[model samples]
Target: MLNFERLQILQKYYDYIQKKTGVRDYFLVGGALRDILLGIKEKLDDVDLTIAGEPIGLYAQMEKEAFSHFITEKFGTITLIPKEGVMQGIKYEITPFREESGYQDVRHPDDIRWTNSLLADAKRRDFRINAMYYRFLNIKKPVYEEKKVLDSTTLLKVLDREGFVFLENSGVLIVQNSSLIDQLLQNGQMDSDFLYYLLDIQHFAYCYGEEGEKTDSDGRFDLQIVIDPEYGIHSLINRKLETVGDPDIRFQEDALRLLRGLRFVNVINQKLLNNENKEQNADPLNKVRLFDFETETWKSIKKNHDLLKTIAKERIYQEIVKSFSEGNPFGLVALVDEAEMLPILFPALAKTKGYDQPIRYHPFDIYAHIILTLWHLQQINSNYLVRFAMLYHDVGKVGQYEQYGLNLTREEIRNILAGPLNHRFSSAELMKEDFRNLGFSNKEIEEIKRYINEHHTPGEILMGNSQNWTKRLRKLFSEVGYEKLQNLLDINIADRLGMYNPLQNSSDLTDSYYLKTLVDEIEQTEGQFKKSDLAITGADVMEHFDLKPGKLIGELLQVGFDWVLGDVKHRNVKKQILANIANYLKQKK
Candidate 1:
């Protein structure tokens, strides 16, 4: 059942819509419903509803009331964002009851047949666990008493089954079975002549976890719910992942479902593992196991994995972002490799599977090293760009190793490390094309490339003394600002933890901490790493040096900027910068 606070908010919208269109047969469906049953309350800020008629007319009416809406006419869907009211910041998407067929392009339906049957809509969903629905029932207003009525044997039975909510503030008791209310009235359990006359209490029942056929002789359950037609609640309890119908037909209709199915498994399995220790005391013998793909689902994925090529790169990138945002990217990456989807999704990265590195430094092959890096990175940072940088950080080494062969002398490998600029540049160039195909903006591509370039800087600084570190660190700070440097440090730490180098030790991490301290100190004393940090600006240089508004003024400002970075104390002394630039111009003689 939905919580009282969110349910109350949803009730307001339901009342608003019912007053306008007189449509009472609608459902809260899809992921919002699935998550609520999983004991996940934080992600229920959005709601998805499937109504019994065309959504365009209702959307048009909502537009008149000044609610912003985006519609897809082909699918009869509308995403409505409320600009004002008690439901502000909550997103609501409404789709008319419809069935789909003839997916020629493997994504959209070639024809959508609108219907009043909720079962048809449930059958068209991708996964069984996502097919359940939640809807309220129509019942006479419940009689309210000043004394406690929660102890009524009839109401207690419904509440024990976990499908009812009692709104304490409004004195409205909501139950799924109207039959239970009849019993309450007959037993004279309430203090009123009639059920409390609460008009807004209509949206209160949670009709889920049962079959449509199992209802009262009056067929009241059939009227309010088509819950679990695919046995979704059963599968959810066992931690299973299976397609709603035929796996092959579903995957062929939309190949992106292949990856999405795996992402679901990965995320749900992570949640199950996290809850295992907590659940041990509650039921030691019946602890829930992690999720596994149903047998047919696994077989279908292997057969149709190649169909991913037909999907758009931008769409694929969106799925990747969603998986990474869930905080267990390594699990998803590993599952992608196990399913053989890695070769189709990232051919270059797949080629690194058996590529060897210097055994003295790396214990795993390039592919295993990359995977381990992602695992370690989760402990330090969850930024997608930081993770991506570590993924491709050593991809260029595949080509380098091929050129040198596996028999290179240790001295030759040592020389490669001394100047790894070539491989870093090569890796960044390769990442550029991948990012462009994934629809990243030009600015985002450049920022990620800069991170790739500086990935090795932290380890290099770890080898230097504090005096040399200050000079190099300040130069880097001036170039990339503080946040990017912090991200680079995170990548460096994960990379080290992924390796088995004898040259690196616990002291390396100790040095990393010192470097972080220095970064904070530099930022606190020098302020932002921009021209504003300099005591003199372009105008000041032009005025004090008698220079015109041209390139010379900009160059003289850089001179002052560099002087301040040399010693932050110089920033507070304008005369020192003027004298420094004066000496710099004299040197131009």
Candidate 2:
């Protein structure tokens, strides 16, 4: 018996479609099939169906049933959503069997032709493992319980003479359909050789074809059923799965697949390592090997790495985000570097690879330091903004010595090298286009820039004496805001931990205690630190000094705000402020 519980949704939808349009050539394809075969029990929110006939006919039938659907005539696909039933709210994407022609842009098909052959459609998919399909047959009894309703028995219905067949685990079962079998055999649609060939089990040599079948008195044959064990003999077989066509041609057809291939390599390596940890003596033969591409594929990618530049920035950004979101982002990035795509995708990161830092402060070069910082962020489970900040934090250090020259005075060098003013600002300025091109929202890009610009301020404040530290801390907090201050501290801590030295272990660059105390003090203190917080406004200044709304009012407020920053008591001295404004105006005249 088939796994009826696992096949209920497919069966229900198949039956519904067949009842409506009398179409029986639909099959469950794509990731749903791959996930089912992998025994991954995660809840899948979408179902993809490939039908051998016109989907628009099914679309018209579904419309009569009042089912909502979206049609795309360009690709011959329709997304149907049932209004009521066990599969309510679920979206099923139904597409007619079609083949793609040219991909001169490396992203889209230049021409699409409808086909009636399932095999032809399967051959056009990206990978062998994702190319399988599952066909389900309708039966008389209730196949499985519907979890969404209380009365499951009400769903059962008797079938007519049309008959039904269910395909499961890459094998098809015809239920009470001997005539359909004979029809398939005569029409060259469902012969045993074709079935076994589709299942990749022909090597077992269990023939169910016309040559070796036992015929009943009515001339119907009973074929021997061949099932692969759970830990099947196929696991022992080694097969190299190339792309459907030439690997170079595939990459040229879609350059994004190059990055996808690298991601797969890292993902496969991680899975292998996890499996190795679970079973110390696991057979090496049981592991799925990485896809070994032809040498020409690598050559084509290296030659056409710039083709990635031609792809939509949003698409490239999505691939980059997926790479970083994986368990092994560092490894994946290393692979990107190996493929020479990093320079094209992230020229900022590429420039940092060999740039050296002062040995006393940094143990690794600029690129390694950034990677180490990212590793720290990963350890803390930091969000993407913090991780991205760490990635570009020190990229501005490249060519700094040559740009600024080596003969600068200590104070001048410090001013130029300060995070907020020079390197951080420069890096943020340089990355604006890169970040925007990578599909980051304007708000996200600004926030990242804020983090990079202020990453060093927290440490600077923490290392200061308490005398002026509050003022500095308040300024930093006001500039970066409360939410971003936390992120800035995270980047600071990661950057400090990433530095190389004997004392690195002892450093608390984030200075959580001190920063927290500063936060608490700022919260408790009611005095003005900003011009807007001054007790006297620009209107007060203009009225008291007998001046209209002009530059003089703003100048007077700045002087008062400066005094307030140095001593909060200055905010209450209205008469003294008026006297100071007069003197300041006298000096200006």
Candidate 3:
């Protein structure tokens, strides 16, 4: 129910709509009903509602009001959002009622049938938990009706026996009957084997498991499936990265969640076991706890987190500015790392282990270094775009390895401790092929491959003359799209950690320096480069020389700039640097 203040705002819009079109009915439903039902024992912050009949303009009226609420139209369905935290600060959304066609495609409906019957409107929805209603009547005066919100008991009644619902909390509601599952199996509403296995009716799995594909979608859950008793969702969502190789199938059913299987186990296990421990205590859920030992699952999740590269540099910049302004950036790096689809979604991350850079400057191999690399990134910068990008920066190392490997000369490795640059393409191709098998979109796989290609040039690290630190910064910005700059430092740090090669008895002397250098850079490199702050302008160089500001002048300026960054002698005098460049150009001529 709206409080006095909300009632006034709601009544004002209600009257405006009624005056415009004599409409008599307006009420709430969907999430509001679910919340109200759930709120009997729990606190709810916002109310959601639906109007039985209303045109598009009603939404405009809601927006015109003084209070803050969201308004949008999704697939011709009008929606309104109210300010969050009125009661306890819950966000509210109001949407119009309309019929949806069956999910003919896995993503969204093909058509919508308009409706006046709100009950009929919600009936064809996917989940029983989502299909609920609450009604209201509009009058000259604010007439509030007191109706019984569906309590936990009432909701439990109509849920089909095979239907399953679990609360975010410990509430469990299941329909014991198999009629719906059986009907779905026959009529092809669902794959019988998945329903059976997923619901733990293991006995019935053989009935539908083998032929499920011929009886179902083009993609079959065939021989590749290796279900270890210990491998499950809890292990998947852990801080450790795990890759769900078949993301298409894992996500196709209920993909939004990282690991729904664990959520099910959480509720189902409570019903299955109560432990007082040795004396009969509630069992701390052995099955749920056991998955941590699943080596394969741990490998997958680790791969997944391993594969998630970074956000673009420009986006990182904005988030940092916002964090500074708001004083609470909300730890976006942790959020990105924690997202379920990240490893698979970002294939570059999925393949992070291909190259094992010798541990010279860091304690960990490339993979382990990336994790600690993230820790170093976080303490220095907090935004998602920056920290995450840093985490993902060397992600291309996977792609760069083969090219780096094939070109390796024993002479160079013994002396410089690095490999050649040609390997990124071959490595990228291998990874791209792998991604194709795993079902990632083509565009992303390509971008990630290119990212690996350009991100870490051995020349930059070793013999090739360097770009001015700022130009190198500009190069990364230009290549990956400037949106992710602030966090790209993560890649450099991770790469630095890759330089670490620990010895059996102690640390390598060279590695200690590399580690110290990387650790030093975390604090040294923050907010280090930008076009807005530079010693010499592009215009200044052009004006000083008899040169136009085209490629030649830019090249000459760049050389001078590098000398300064490399700390070459006489670098403080721009004239001396420019004179050195002019002499080098004359010798070439």
Candidate lDDT values, in order: 0.68, 0.59, 0.39
Per-residue accuracy of model 1 over 1-41 as CA lDDT, tens digit each: 22222333244455554543345555677776565456444
At residue 124, give the lDDT of candidate 2.
64
| Local accuracy of candidate 3 as per-residue lDDT tens digits, 1-589 | 1011111223233333333323334544333333222221133344554554444655654442423444464554443333322322334445555666544333355666655554445444332333443222211111113223333243333232324321111111122234433432332123435433433432122110011112114332211111111111122223122223344332232222223222222322222222122234434563322112134433333344422233232332343333322222223222334544434444455456434664544444555556556555555555533443344555545545544466757675443333332344444555565455444456655554554454455225432333344444433443443433333434444445444444432222353344334424532543233332335556766776666768977777666665554433335365676576778688879
User: Highest lDDT among the candidates is held by which one?
Assistant: 1
Top-scoring candidate (TM-score): 1
Global fold similarity of model 1 (TM-score): 0.78
- RMSD (CA, Å), candidate 3 to true, equals 16.4
- Candidate 2 on 1-589: residue-level lDDT in tens? 1122343334455556555445555666665554333333234567787766665665665543635778897787887777777667777788877888799888888988877666557556664445555564322211222212211121111112223322222223322233433334332134545333332421222111122222345534322222211111111112123344566666777778777666655554554454456776877776644334345656665676767776888887777776566545667667778788888776888988877777778877889988888877666644667677778887777756445566888887777776443777877876776788788888878878888887787777766776877666666565565556657767777788788566455265446556756666665674225556667888888777678998867778877665555556444477766676678778888
Minimum summed lDDT over a 10-residue window in model 3 is located at 224-233
Better of 1 and 2 by TM-score: 1
Better model by TM-score, 2 or 3? 2
- Report the CA-based lDDT of candidate 3 relative to the real structure: 0.39
In candidate 3 the C-alpha lDDT for residue 188 amounts to: 17
